[model samples]
Target chain A: MNIYLRLVYRNIRANLDRASLFFELIFPLFFIFVQGFGLNGIVPPFDVGNGRVISYSLFLAAGAVTLTVINGGTNAGTQLWFDRKNGMFEQLLMGPFTRAQYILSIIFATLIIGVAGSLLVFGFAFPVLGASFAPTWEGALLIAGALFLGTMFFGAFAIALSVVLKSSETFQIVSTFAFFIFLFTSSVFFPASAAPSAIQAASLANPLTYTTDIFRAGLFNAVTPTVSLELGVLAIEAVAMFVIAVFAFRRIRV
Target chain B: MLMAPDQVVRVDELSRHFGDKIAVDRVSFDIARSEVFGFLGPNGAGKTTTIKMLTTLLPSTSGRATVLGHDLKTEGRKIRAQIGVVQQQDSFDQGLNVETSMDLYGLIWNVPKAERRRRIDELIGHFEMQEFRKMPTVDLSAGQRRRLQVAREFIHDMDLLFLDEPTVGLDPIVRRSVLDYLKERVRQGLTIFFTTHILEEAEYLCNRIAVINQGRIVQIDTPENLKRRFGSAKAVEFKLLQGTSSEMASALSSSASVSRFGRDEGSGAYRVTTTRPESVIPEIYRLADRLNLTVSSIYISETTLEDAFINLVTEDEKAVANGGRAS
Candidate 1:
């Protein structure tokens, strides 16, 4: 495992330049601020039981961070495909590390990116929204848990996709399809209550929906009974996806 | 466990197939400690397939093999821990710099942090990659990348090293340097199993070589033994200094000393193949003198590995053709 950690560390340090710190931190922070304030004027605020017009902008901030994590996680598999095409993947296979070690390294790197993105979102949202960003410690832990699992779940999904897809062009099409499907069906842009019954049921099945809801509940301290159930469902899906992904990846012919 | 002084690698019948195509047939061989064993074959032969199986990347279909006394099927992890493999294609992570890449590979082999740092420094100097140590691998040339790849394998002192076509695109100078480094490693008692299509590379580096064709071992012997056994035959080629009459060429072709002969249509030269070049040479000179035929150049040469390969493959093709007709 020390080897796996070192590999991940080396890769992240080298690629940190490719994913410029300015773009990763400052650009997303700027986008969240601009989009949050701009959308505030267009959509009317929601009325919670506390009688305050709740700014859904905080939800957007969380959603943006989650989006960054999702992008990084999905791109992990595409990066492996690129490596394979460029001869790097063959190198790793011939190394002393096992396939499990390789996959774990990817997952570790994704987790770091996801956590960093989430923290950056928090750093921006808490300052601008003031009292509206009041989140309990328990809620923060739950959000962190959700993001960690969500990143691994999607990252593993991408690994499975990498094994089945031969080319990056086909992988892009599949990634785009997966992205929009998760976005439209999840609670990223809207509430599950407003969605139709069948749509709500489908959202319940989508792991991203659970992740988004968990983030929303954590940031706003608005934990409904449904949130717990979604968290449970997401946990089960994360484990199942991880197992399936590892199994599928094991069968790949180096 | 450390290998006994005698054994480097040992295998019983090893086989691997992909779908309907058999990549490695029931093949087996052994290499003594400190020996450089070359797996030689043409493209698409079972060289890479067998190497992959030996390196524990691909499982054999039906076979038993051991490396340094560790069972390949059960102790693959242990075997892999002690072996280093450099694939045919460039396999280093291009995102990292040379030093970092070596450091990461060292860590993978469980080298201590201090040892890894020391080794990285040593290798960077050894490979003469200091100028490019800080640059990303994408910026390095093909030869430079190959140097890093070969250096990365030695970050930790492994008991066995497997290199697949390590000099595929390298120029002669760089190829020699890589081969010399491999030789040095062998002198340090590291068993090297490398594959290559270039026959001369095997002749230069390998103490023992096995030539595989169509998933079967066609021949296995030292370069000297192979040459003495299959490469002693000679070819005598001569070019006509002036255009000879058709009658003179036909008369030359009828000599009993000539085993086989062919005329070049464009150059109008004649080439003859014979095991006894001494007798054939005098006959050719006498015939030319008697006919007043001028000889531009007459050269007698020994057979090469390339010739042996062609002869072996052609013979195999003939056998197959005859078998088909018989069937």
Candidate 2:
């Protein structure tokens, strides 16, 4: 077996804990169920500025899928923190592999986790929430591309983060901070049109908003403005994060 | 044997710096194949820093080193592939059990499956970890975990092994077992770079020992030669029935063989450090009898490795105090 593959497998398997399950599966599903049933039609009907009346649950489910991408990236970055606390970093640095290879393994493993997790949430949402949704070929392609690029972008960000942060408490703060900021700015709970002007502006610049747009367009068959532009931006961000992560990892002491 | 002359590790003027402070000075040495080279010093004596630099774990600030003829800087991966290290701290995959940890380590080192199983079984038995083979490594006792840590490295074949205080928290029997295990490996043509602050273990195991102090190699010689170089006086002890008196102090000070005399505060016994204990013993007896001092006990002891160790470190400290250092 390839050493890098073995390392990645070990990391992913090690992350199989109740907390990971709750964060990736149960936590998002809880939001989906509560919003899907509790607010399906109870509130006054409101239309987005574009004359599209989007349901709250569908919007939340799309956002929840993208949440998995962010979760996967942060979790992957924290794997290095655990390894450092346990002295495995020193042991591995002295082994046969280079530091870059070790960092890459974590990134790849987290990418797998993010993609699989988003797929799980996306596929299971229809039967669980009773939402009648199916994908056209173009919709499916955009969703897959967005999830892939978003996972890579966040995975790279997490690796670069793990390289600089020292304590787990601080890392938790940073990850939680990033997650909530991205969650609120993106169209997770409501369409950007329903949010205030400030949040709408924030969403315009947030990479996650573009990812959520791609997800929403595919899952609910909604029309996204300039779909190709979103794909290009996501691709560019993913490439930039990967290159920076690889560059920053070299400065970390053994 | 020291004469094997294979020179598996050759370090020249190696040094490491953390910020402005130098952790390891310009230290140089060589290790032959199949020899147990012990590095002895106290904590913070640069033993670990030097080991880290030589193992290619930490880059040196200034130096030239070659492990297996591969340069330390450019060929680190090649060197790492051929060497193994057991660091001072305990490291294990907490999620894996003892047996699985061994298997995974062997697997990471790219050992074949058949050989991995064979070595795992052999190491488990050899380290007396059979009962805890199925237990999680994080839950094992410190000594048991250490056994596993040291034994797991043997899963891979290597030309050189670096052990940094491998028996720090072990019992006497386990420590001896670890030493003997290392001895057997040395006999099988494995060169070991062992660091320990324990003088007795160094004496029992090392063929040639290097005494490091304040980030410098103060002395490098056989255990016997180290004692000969740093040791010149033996201890002669005398216990009197009563507390020490002015008369006994005067006699010891005027004796020809005795150079230093003092009463131990704890035992109230007297110690006379002398160059010639044979003549000093008779002189002590004659003085005690003449003064009507009831001598309870008297004994002459040779210099020990511990004594030699303390002396060497003290000399280096004094030299530093006097602003003298080795080139």
Task: Report the C-alpha lDDT of model 1 over A1-254, residue by residue, as the tens digit.
Answer: 56767768755664445564446566446646787778878877774223334666765666666776676666567666766776766666666667787778877887787677777767766677664556589788878878987888787788778778878789878987987788778777666667899878888788888887777677667677766787888889888988987887787776
Worst 10 residues of 1 chain A by lDDT: A47-56
lDDT of 2 by residue, A49-72 (tens): 235466666667778788888888
- Write the residue-wise lDDT of candidate 2 on B1-327 in tens digits: 122248898888899999988888898899988888999987898999998888888899998998887889999999999999999988887777899888888877889999999999988877888999999877999998899999999999999999999988889998898899899999999999999878889999999999888888888999998887787699888898877778989878887778899889998889999877879888888888899888898887878888888999998999999898656
lDDT assessment of candidate 2: 0.83
Candidate whose DockQ is highest? 2
Query: Which candidate ranks first by lDDT, i.e. highest?
Result: 2
Assign candidate 1 its CAPRI class: acceptable
lDDT, residue A106, candidate 2:
85
Each model's lDDT: 0.76, 0.83
Q: What's the TM for model 1?
A: 0.86
Best by TM-score: 2
Candidate 2's C-alpha runs over 4 A off are: A15-19, A42-55, A130-138, A218-225, B1-5, B236-257, B260-272, B276-299
